[model samples]
Target chain A: MSDTLDAALRLMRAQAALVRRFDARLGGLHGVSLADFTLLLRLAQAPGGRMRRVDLAEALGLTASGVTRALAPLERIGLVSREPDARDARVAYASLTGTGRERLPEMLATAEETADELFAAPAWGERDVPVLAGLLTRLGGTGLRS
Target chain B: MSDTLDAALRLMRAQAALVRRFDARLGGLHGVSLADFTLLLRLAQAPGGRMRRVDLAEALGLTASGVTRALAPLERIGLVSREPDARDARVAYASLTGTGRERLPEMLATAEETADELFAAPAWGERDVPVLAGLLTRLGGTGLRS
Candidate 1:
């Protein structure tokens, strides 16, 4: 039981390290951090490639203030734009801009490569990739605004 | 494929968030971050709760300087001690103190609870846990170093 528990810890750690490395490398290549990449990815999920700032924070499990700190750099870089919502003047909407849309393809490609490398681990068949991915996603608890 | 890819990324992000939460909570309880807890765990693996600093770095997938930085706080707390290796003046050794030994069980119990809470992902089982753990340990690229 203890041994298995150790394995779960290791699995989590290995995955975290890989993400950090990929984030640092790919992020450095394009002058963004992993946190920046994540924000962009979140924006990409919206209908017009954007989300409300508070929504993005909840999605990422980050405090609204931390989201603001991360967004400042992205906004400064022109990757994100915050404007008063047309329907709700008090709410600010964070939307991707021309710069963010343009840079995403490159980031996505780099992400794929990193995933490819990690998937090369033994017994990790190509098919098993989706299986594990499914388990993780359901476990991730995304879109739980309720 | 895109859906699955998103899932993989989500799994990775969720795992990172969970660990960070655990580290924060555990740090409050033990005055040690997860990284510090790991160093203590590694020290306990040595013949008599002692190992060379370089080896510790290698075992933890950390650069020597990173290990040095982590050691500073532990040494200050007297939970661990560092000394020049008796046989090799150039080598530094890290050893656990009586306080450290006494504290290990408490930390381990906290760790077990944290793991149980964080990695309670679907489809996980005791049988699959070791296989994943051993695979992740190897994935860390430290197999040859240890």
Candidate 2:
């Protein structure tokens, strides 16, 4: 905890807050919560339009139970269709239906605009963007390098 | 969506995963959970080891309710003390406790390593961190900018 450390915290705090805002605005614009929007997009883009529950859970950084809970809204909207896996009855396959595929493009577009806006905080100059990203990347190294 | 839009989604997905990983690893390395850990550090570095709940909420990008909930654990652990604002009874003040002040340095050291490790994603080289920070700051500009 020196002055440099204090300065780093400000940058890290900004980095974390920006990511959360990206989700909020993106979700608000799309009329779909960020978490739900991601689920829809993931299912729509997956091969065969389906993914195993466990794999989907991993992709989402959620526990299996968290995914089940999150799926309720998607299922209610008919955007998601979950079924017993053909190869493994114990596994459930979650896929995007026609409605989800149709809605995804619109949501995706709004989301990107939100992302672009979030990426450009005025307080920090344009040059600050990539510099902070690089510094954060270095600070967060997994200890495999110098 | 066009190819470029899809690329944005790809970036969102990758960054979201990295943030979650960063949070998880930070919590694991130290006994402090991510939310509590961030709270303590912010409080310690604030003007007087205290700040308005709304300001903290804004800084943390958490909704009011989310901030309230996050404060509960900290308060319970005696790391944070909550008091009704004399100027505005409806508002609450969250101040770091003496214990919290003493513990801040150690917690931050843990964060330094975690932040460094996670920011070191191969995708963001040393030179790219500040640029990403700037972009993320801009990204927070539109909407609630929460």
Candidate 3:
């Protein structure tokens, strides 16, 4: 494989391992997948703790229908709620519920702890995080943009 | 979020986008998902184009059952085959068939092309590839070991 392909494959594999770790911890402790945590985190970062469905899809690199499907479970669990736009009936929003807000800090703590452990000690260098973040941003992984 | 958590989240999102792109192309062109392509590529790289099922699972970051479930469709499609260990009947190996070997180059070309496009142009700097790959390796991405 070409260098680019080699790197892309590595990225995929590494991400898979990372997700499995995150899911195990997040699911066992918080009853949330990494995906759910990401959704809640994004909502928390948004103004009024809500975002338009289309915008959320764009930010997460998912389709509009995918965003809807992802939101359904969170909505059912009362961790998220839907709001219809008053003027434009076609427009809708996803908002983090009070329950979601209350629970998110704990989730964030777990995720952060998991991440710190993953990158700690002999495995990672001091300079690695910024460099990796910059590289990921090039692939449209703009993280936690307020 | 801490810098570590931010980078981790970015990695997750970037991988998701990359997988979707790879899946769309690999699936449309080769009738294979990225996961299937990764399995085939790994087998192709193995000595004699085969590996023990347990080892394959370890390399792919999947459970033993996941390897079996993933192999089922490929085995049905003739891209992969099962080999009984002659001495140890309890152990099984996965081998890339002749058809698989023949077809892999084309699949690889498609993957390489897709990856190239993703990393091309103003978005990607020349130094980005090596830096990113090194970072991914720290997360146990290891790339193509053979």
lDDT of each prediction vs. the true structure? Answer: 0.72, 0.65, 0.90
* Candidate order (TM-score): 3, 1, 2
**Comparing 1 and 3 on DockQ, the stronger one:** 3
What is the TM-score (0 to 1) of candidate 1?
0.84
Interface RMSD of each: 4.5, 6.6, 4.4
Give the runs in model 1 whose Cα sits over 4 Å from its true position.
A86-90, A121-123, A143-146, B1-4, B117-128, B134-138, B143-146
Error of 1 at B105 (Å): 1.5
Candidate 1: CAPRI quality band: acceptable
Fnat of all models, as shown: 0.35, 0.15, 0.79
Model 3, residue pairs in steric clash:
none
Error of 2 at A131 (Å): 9.9
DockQ of each: 0.36, 0.25, 0.54
Stretches of model 2 off by over 4 angstroms after superposition: A1-30, A116-146, B1-30, B84-91, B120-126, B141-146
Please provide, for model 2 over A109-139, each residue's C-alpha lDDT reduced to its tens digit, 9 standing for 90 to 100.
7776765555434554555544444444434
Model 1 lDDT tens row, B1-42: 254346447666656565676687679788788788878988
Q: Write the per-residue lDDT of candidate 3 for residues A35-132, one digit (tens) a residue.
A: 98998999999999999999998887777888999999999999999999989999899999999999999999999999999899787889889889
Error of 3 at B45 (Å): 1.5
Per-residue alpha-carbon lDDT of candidate 1 for residues A83-131, written as tens digits (9 for 90 to 100)? 7888988688889999899998788777666667666646466566655
Each prediction's RMSD to truth: 3.5, 5.1, 3.6
